[model samples]
Structures are given as C-alpha cells and as structure tokens.
Target: MEHAGKHALVTGGGSGIGKGIALALAHAGAEVTITGRRADTLATAAALHPRLNALEMDVTDEASVREGIAAAAALRGPVRICVANAGIAEGGPFAQTTLADWRHMMATNLDGAFLTFQAALATLGDDDAARMIVVSSIAGVRGLKNAIPYTVTKHGVIGLIRGLSEEYMRRPITFNALCPGYVDTAIVRGQLPGLMRRFDVDEQGAIDIIAKGNRHRRLLQVDETTGAAMWLCSDAARSVNGQTIEISGGQV
Candidate 1:
C-alpha cells in the first residue's frame, strides 16, 4: 500500500481521476510526474504536493510522449507506475458522428494509451518491475447509446492492455485497465449544461439524469477510482495482469 521511492507517471493528471491518482501516489511518498497538454493546470496540480512534478506533454503526439517521458525519467527515475488516463468523452448521435470526430477520439483515447505505454516501457530495464494502468470507461464493456466513437475508443484501450499483458507475460511488468462508470468529474460536469439544454431540465436535474446510468444511481467520488489505481500499484497486485477493474456500481 506504500510506494516510498517509486517513480509514477500519470497522464491527464491535471484534473479529475488522473489528478486524484497522482495526488494519492504523491502522498504515498512516490516521486510523481504528471503530464498534460496544459502547463497551467499541470502546475496547479503539482503545487498541491511536493512529491508531484509537472510535465507538459500531449498524449496525441508521438515525439512529445517520447521526449517527455525521457525527460521525466531523467529527473525522477525509470517509471515504475504508468497510468494512461488522458481521454475525452463526447456524446453525439451516431448518424451525426463525422470521420474527424471519430479520428480525434481514436487518437486521444486509444492511440494515447498506446504511445504512453510504449514510451514508459522503454524507460524500464529488463529486470525492472512496472505497472501500466489504463483509465477506460464502463462503456468499454458494453455499448453506450449516442456515444459510438467514445465507446469504441474505450473498448480499444481495453484490448490494448489485454494484448500487452499476454505479450509481456514473462516480463516483470503488468498491464491492466480501470473501467469506471459516471463519476463526479469535470468531464461529467461539462456535459451537464448540454444535458440541461437537451432535456429542458435544471443543472441538478441533468446530474440526476446522468447518475441514473450507474447502477447505484449516484455520481461516484474521484477517490473511488483513485483507490483502485493505488491498489494496482501495490505489491499485492503484482500478479494481477491483463485484467479490467470495473468501478461501476455493479456489473454492466
């Protein structure tokens, strides 16, 4: 449950689940590197903890990921924990989904995980132990109406982790995915206005509508997901590989 001197890297660590995980790891005494496209946001999150360091990197860009990880490793050490949590969730009618929207989702969610894992793995030596966690969604395990592209990307990341776990079965690294349901995140909050407009309801009404999607009919706290990520990083989960830890209220 403790990581005294480990080096952990979390993408999209500026806010929400990613930020929560980064802060938790830092509190556990790990030298944490948090990366995001926004420097200001990253800095704000990093400032919350002395163990947290901010790194500006776009998960969608290959060169950025490679260089950013290398720089982080140089400063902190080889990454022992890598969390690929950078993604966007945009819901729209399937018929109205353009190719551009599909590509953007694919790039940020699926491709971002691929690049982050590849680059972080490169920092580890043959004998080094590492944990790779992907922050997918509940939509990954089932079809989500009106969110075809987002669901596809989430599912794609789950596949990426599964294949990677098998491919590196003999290695000291473990690959896993965390599929969480609707949480009280900025992403969820951002969708509230749209939901209100579409449903002709108030803010609280929109939130209630979204909460109904979860089996518990509630918006989960960020700590719920962060706790799972912290457990996967612990020694107890060393054998937990090629698995998906669903954080939804119940099975989808």
Candidate 2:
C-alpha cells in the first residue's frame, strides 16, 4: 500500500497495458481513475476493483480532456500519479502513408499524451510529489520499417517527457517514459488478422510472425510493462526522472 490515499489517473485504462497499470495501482491502495472513450469498457474495468473509478474521456478532444480530468480530480483528489498510456499503433510504407494517416497517429499517440499529462499536472499542489509516466515503445528509441509515422509519434512522447522533467526539476513532479517492445495486448491481437492474411497463417502463426519484431523473438506481456510503471510511481523512483525504461527482454 505504498500508494495509499494517493490519486492516480491512467488514460486508455479500459484495456491492454493501460488496464494492467490501473489495476496494479488500485491494488496498491491508490484511488485510481481509469479513463477511455468507451464508457462500457471503463465501467467493466471499474467493477473489477472498488478503488477504481470509471471516467469517459476522449484524450484527443481538448474540452473533453480538461473537463474529464477536472471531474476526476474532484472525485478522487489531485492526480498524484498520472500515466498517459493511451495510444494507437499503425504502420505503412512511408511513401504510401497519407497525411490523414499521419495526423491520426499524431492526434491519438502524441496529442493524446500531451493533453493527459497537462490536465493531470494542473491538479497537483505545490507540496505534492507526483509521477507522470508516458508509455512509449522501443520504436521510440529506434526506427521501425513500414511504421515511420508511429515511430515518430513514439519518439515525440519521449521528448515530451524529457522536456517536462527538466522544467519541473525544482518541483515535486518527475516525468519519464516506458519504452516497451511489442507488447501482447489488444493492439497486438488486432494485428493478428492482418498478419494472418499477409503470411497465410493461423492466429498462433501470425503471432509468431510478429513476435520476431522483438529482439527476444517473443511478445512481452502487459503486466511485465506494468511492473515498471508501478515502480516508477513509487516513492523510491522520485529521483529517476527524464529517463527511458526499455523492456524488450534484451538490449534494444
């Protein structure tokens, strides 16, 4: 219960890595607010634990983010642990990637994180020590073929965290990014169909095909990444700021 009485906000908490972190925080005694675009999904997640509160929030919409976060703070308290974990992954040839495709990734991956952290920071008090974490990808640190736009957005989030951590150096807040390899989440599951068609394989075969993207030749679990996120929010990590935690089962 290291986080007892602290208020935490996690964007995209309805499923995948986001849900894993939200559940971990709630179990650790934080009053966690789990937000997403789908109310039903959020509601189902909240029912898993009494400490979790469901909030309908669209991170890409300015008014929605500001007002949603304000309401969350009012209910749970100031967000002492903000995890901007909502993001979308898309890939295509750089030559064929349309402006709309690029902007869509930017809106959800980069802009969404910007809004979530900014709104959550507004709720903090001067004396409150807080942790603001951005969930990025290994692609952030290196380029990934056929996913130029996604790679750019992930890199952008890391930059955002670095700059924020420096700006708040004198404050009680720390900013950091978690860059995990291809995580086994809904996002990965959704890729199975596309991969199956491309490789003429079944579900498991498709998974194996994509797992090669990781240096370890396997997909990392959602909880594996959540462990790093939970640790970052703990008091011990107060000094670990403006850093990137890479969890790819090997050196990136």
Candidate 3:
C-alpha cells in the first residue's frame, strides 16, 4: 500500500490510460476520485474499484472544476496526488484547422490541466508530499504532421508542468509529465476509421500508420503508461520533478 492514506484525483478516469492509473492507485490504498464529463462512465469505472469514487467534472469549465474538486477533497481528505489525464486527440493540417478546433484542443488538453492543478493545489498542505502528473503526448516533444492543434496543446501542457515545478521548487510537491506514444486505447480505436478514410487505406494499413508512431511499431498497452505514473507518484521519485518521461519504445 504505497499510497495508503493518500487521496488521489484522476481526471478523465472513465476509461483508457486514466482508468488504468485510477485502478493502480486504488490498489495501492489511496482513496481515488475519478472525474469525467460522463457521469455514467465515471460511475461504471468507480464501480470497478472499491476504493474509487466518482465525480462529475467538466475540466474545460473553471467553475465546474473548482466545485467538483472541492467536494471531492471534502469527502476523501486533501488531494496529495493528481493526474491530469483528460484530453482530446484530433488532427488536421495547420491551414485546415479552424479557430474552434484550436480552442477545443486548448480548452480540454491544456486549460483542463491548468484548472485541475489549481483546484488540487488548494487542498494540499504545506508539509505534505504531493505529485502532479500531466498526461502529455510524444507530440509535445516533436511536431506531428497534420496534427498542429494537438501538438500545440501538448506542448502547452509540458510547459505548464515545467513552470509549476519551478514555482514550487522549495515545496514538497513534484510536477511532471508523461509523454506516451500511440497507446492501445479507445481514442486510438476511434481514429482508425478516420485514418482509413483520409488515406484511402484498409483497416490494417490504418493500424500500421499509427503503430509506426512508436519505434517498435506496435501499440503500447495502457498498463505501460500506468506503471510510469505509479513510479512518479511513489515516495522514491521525490527528486524527479519537472521531467517528461517518454514511453515511445525508444528515444524520440
């Protein structure tokens, strides 16, 4: 029970990488609050773990995030660990990307993490140890062709973590980011059809196109990312702040 007595909050915990992290935290004895826009999905995910609780939160809205996180902290004690894993993955050429598209990506991927971290920091005690992990993507490190909006949003998230890490350098809180490449998640599955349509390719070709993003040419399992999150949240990682741990099978 490495996380015993710790109250952990995971945004976008309804499915995929967030769900994996939530389950791992619960198993480690933390009182976990799983947040998502979909109440039904949150409830279903919470049901899977006895220590996990569900909260309805729209990370894109400041008011909702402030209220929802406050309520969760009241119920589960101060939040010592927070995972900002909620994001949308949409891709298009920079010229073809609309203003609305850029705003949507920023609101969910970048703004969401900002709101979540702010609310979570309010609950942390001065002497208590804490971890804030932002789920960024490999796109944050390098630009992805035809994914200008996503790349920009991810880069923003990494910047948020780095700035926060420096601001809290003297404090016990550690801020870091995880940059994973093409994880086998529902989000990737949703992109397959779009990939096929855009490239005029079959299903295998569509899959291959994404798999090639990783050096090993295979989709990473959700557990791989979860393991990295768990390590960062552990007491042993006290000195590992302001770093981006990439899970792209090799150096990016």
Tens digits of per-residue lDDT, candidate 1, 75-126, equal: 8899999999999988889999999999999999999999999999999999
User: Cα miss at 234, model 1 (Å)?
Assistant: 0.7
Candidate 3 structure lDDT: 0.95
Tell me how far candidate 3 lies from the true structure as C-alpha RMSD in angstroms: 1.1
lDDT of each: 0.94, 0.93, 0.95
Poorest 10 consecutive residues by lDDT, candidate 3: 89-98
Candidate 2 per-residue lDDT, tens place, 91-168, comes to: 889999999999999999999999998899899888889999999999999999999999999999999999999899
The local lDDT score (0 to 100) that residue 12 gets in candidate 3 is: 97
Give the winner by lDDT: 3
**What are the per-model numbers of colliding residue pairs?**
0, 0, 0
Error of 2 at 76 (Å): 1.3
Q: Model 3 off-target regions past 4 Å?
A: 198-201
Residue pairs whose backbone atoms clash in candidate 2: none
**Colliding pairs, model 1:** none
All candidates' TM-scores?
0.98, 0.98, 0.97
- Clash pairs, model 3 backbone: none
